[model samples]
Target: MPGDSRAATNAATVLRTVLEHGPVARGGIAGLCGLSPAAVSRQTTALLRGGLLRELPGPADGVGRPRIPLDLHTGAVGGPVAAGLHIGVPSSTFSLVDLRGRLLARRAFPHEGRPPAGLSGEIAVGLGRFLAEFDSGRPLLGVGAALGGWIRPDEGTVVHHPVLRWRHKPLGAELSAVLGLPVRVDNHARAVARAEILFGRPEARGSLVHLFIGNVVDAAFGIEGTVHQGPGSAAGDVAHLPVPGSAAPCACGRTGCLQATASDTALGAEAVRRGIVPDPSVPLLVDAAATGDPRADRLLRERARAVGRAAALLLDVFNPALMVVTELSSVLDEGYLEEIRTAATALSHVCDDPRRIVIPHAGPAVLPEAAATVLLSRVFRDPCRSDERARSHPSV
Candidate 1:
C-alpha cells in the first residue's frame, strides 16, 4: 500500500478499536486492532488533537499515566457533532449525533404542501434554526443528508427523486452553501446500511441487507464492512421488484411491485381508501392500530407480509448474515416485526431462521442516526481527511 493509504488504514483501525472498546488504554487498542504501539500512539495523538478522542481519568489503582484511558470525545460541551438530514416525501428530519452515532437532538420539518422546486432551501433554513437552538458550543463536523431515489454520493448529487421531483440536483453543494457547512449526501437505504455496519450488531459488518420501507421502498447490500454502490451509485432500487401475491398496480403499469405493494405511500393511500385513516399517513394508521383498530391492524399486517415476501427474494439472492428492515410499525412494535420475520422465514428457502430478519438497531431513531452516519462513516474511513475537512471548514 502507498504510504498515505497505509497511514489512513492504520488510523481508522485505531479509531474503530477505541469506538468498540472505549475508555481503553493505548496498549489495549494496539492489541485489539493488531497495530504496533508506535502506530497506535501516532494515531491517538492525531485523533486527540483533532477532537475525535479524549483522555479520561486514569485508574485509581496506581497505574502509570501510560494506562490513561481514551475514548471518543462525547462530552456535552466541546465534543464534535455531525448534523443529519433525512428528506422524506412528507417531512425532513434533522438530527445532531455524537461520534458514536448517538442522536443528541432531532426535529422534524414537515413539507406539508411546500413546493418541491425550492424545498431544499427551505429545509436548509429549518436545519439552520434547529442547529442554532441546539448548538451547545460543540464542534460541528458537518451535515449528512440522506434521502430516497438514485443519489450519486461521489458527486453529492440527487440523480433522481421521483416524489421530490429532483433531477441531477447538486443537493450537497446547495445545502452546504445555505448552511455554511460541509454536506455529504447519499441514498437513505445505503446510509442505513452503513450505519448498521458502523454502530449496530457485529454480524452486520460481516454481511447485511437493509430494506427501507417508507414513502419509497429500497434495499442496500453490504459485505465486509463496505456498502456496494454500483454503476452511477444507483444500486439499491427495489421499487419495481415484484412481490408475491401482490396485485397492486404500480405507476409503471406493472402489478405487484414492491413499492406499490409495501411502501408507506401505498399503504397510507390504501388506509385512507379503506377509511382507516383520514389522510395518507402511515403514522396515523399506526396510531389507529395502536388504539385497537382492527382494520388498521389488518392493513399493517398485510403490508408487513408483502415486505417480508420481498425480503425473502433478497435473502435468496444474497443470503446475507443479517437482514435489517426499517419500517415505522416494525421498529416501534415487536408484534409487527414478528409478523415480518415469520413471513420472511416462511417464504425464504435459504433463510429458515427468523432471527436473521430484524429491525434496525437504532429502532425508532434509525433514519436520524443513519443520516448522520453518512458523514461519520467518512470520518471513520479516513480520519486524516476528516480532520483536514474540519480544519478547512471551521465555521460549522
Candidate 2:
C-alpha cells in the first residue's frame, strides 16, 4: 500500500505537469519533473494503463519524426473525481471536479432556509444522485463543503456561520456518516486560496493572500503553496477590522468594521439608505452603478476605497508576493479596480504602487471551481491511490 501510495504521488506529479502544460512531450515532462526518460516512459505507461493519459495528434504540417504529446484524459473512464459543495447565504452549489482540474458537472440552487441538519441530509441525497450519473469506474475520492464563516477543520465542525445560523455544526462528520465517504469542511475564502494553489496561476504557489469581497469580506493567506491557517483556523478574520472614514455601526457594537461598510451586502444596504436602489440587493446596486447612477457610483467607490485600505493592511502585515482580490462587481472592472488600488496605495505605508496584484479573469464559475478544487486536490496529491480505488470497484 505504501509503495502504491508513493507511485500514486509520482503519477500525480506527472499528471500535474501534463495538466499545466498539456499536449506536452514525455521528454519535457521528464525534464520538468527531474526524472529520467525511462522513468517518465514507465510512469506514462502506467498512466495510460490507468486511462488517465491520452496522446494528442502531432503537428499538422507532417514535420520531422512526430513527437506525440500526452494530455490528462477527461470525460473518460478511470479518471478520479470529487464532489464539492459551497453553501452561501442565498444559495448553494454542487460541483464535480476531475483531478486534472476539469469541471465535470455543476448545479446551483436556493436553500429556502433549510436548517444545517436538514441541509446536510439534502446534500447527501443530492451527492448520491450526482455520483450516480458518472461512470462507476470514475473513482470518487471524497466531498468538500465550503461555507462563509469560521471553521474548525481539525474538529471537522463549523464553529460559526452567521448567514447559515450554524454553530458547532458537525458538517464534515454529518456528510461523511450519510454519504459513507471522506469529507472536508472549510471556510470559503480559505478554500478559494487552496484552489488558487491547485488551479490558478503559477505564481499563486508561493506566498499570497486571497481577499474575497462579496456579501462578506474575508481573506486567506497561503505560504509555500499551503494555507497558513492560524489557531483554530481563524487567521484571516478581516471582517471586523476597523476602517477610517466610516461611521457605520457594526453588529459587534463597533463602528466602521470592514464588514459594516465594505461588504457587498453592506454596500447594497447603503445604496438603499441613500435612495440609489429600491431594495437592498447587490445585483440591483451593481445594475444601478453600471447605469451611471451617481448615488450608486459614489457608494461603490467609497466601498472600493474601504476594500483597498483593508488590502493594504494585509500587504503591510503579510507582504506576500501577490494579492488576489475576488470582489463581485467593483474589483472585476478595470476602472473600479484602479480606484480601489489608488485608495489602498494612499492609505498604506508600503503598499504604494502595489503592482503585484491580480484578479481571476475567468467568469462566474470562479467560486464553484474553487469549491471543487478543494476535493480534487486530494486526488492530485495521490493519483495511484485513487486509481487503486477505481480498480477495486467495478461498475455493473
Candidate number of the best TM-score: 1
Residues 1-396 of candidate 1 have per-residue lDDT tens digits of 498789889989988998888989998998888989999999999899989999998889987755889999999968999999999999999999999999999999999888999899999999999999998999998999999999999889999998888999999989998998879999999999999999999999999999999999989999999999999998989999999999999999999999899999899999999998999999999999999999999999998888899999999999999999999999988999999998999999999999999999998999999999999999999887764455577652
Angstrom error at residue 51, model 2: 4.1
- Judged by whole-model lDDT over C-alpha atoms, candidate 2 comes out at 0.76
lDDT of 1: 0.93
Q: Which 10 consecutive residues of model 2 have the lowest summed lDDT?
A: 387-396
Clashing pairs in 2: 8-384
For residues 1-396, could you state the per-residue lDDT of candidate 2 as single tens digits? 677666666787887888788778888898888777876787788887766677777666765322577887765666667788887766788888776555778887677767655776886777767667754687676787788889987666988877667789988878888887778778888888888788777778877898888776779999987897788888778889888787889999999898888887788787888888898787788778788887877777777788888888888888877788877665446766787788777877766665766675334566777777766665566655552354477431
What is each predicted model's overall lDDT from 0 to 1? 0.93, 0.76
Return the lDDT, model 2, position 158: 84
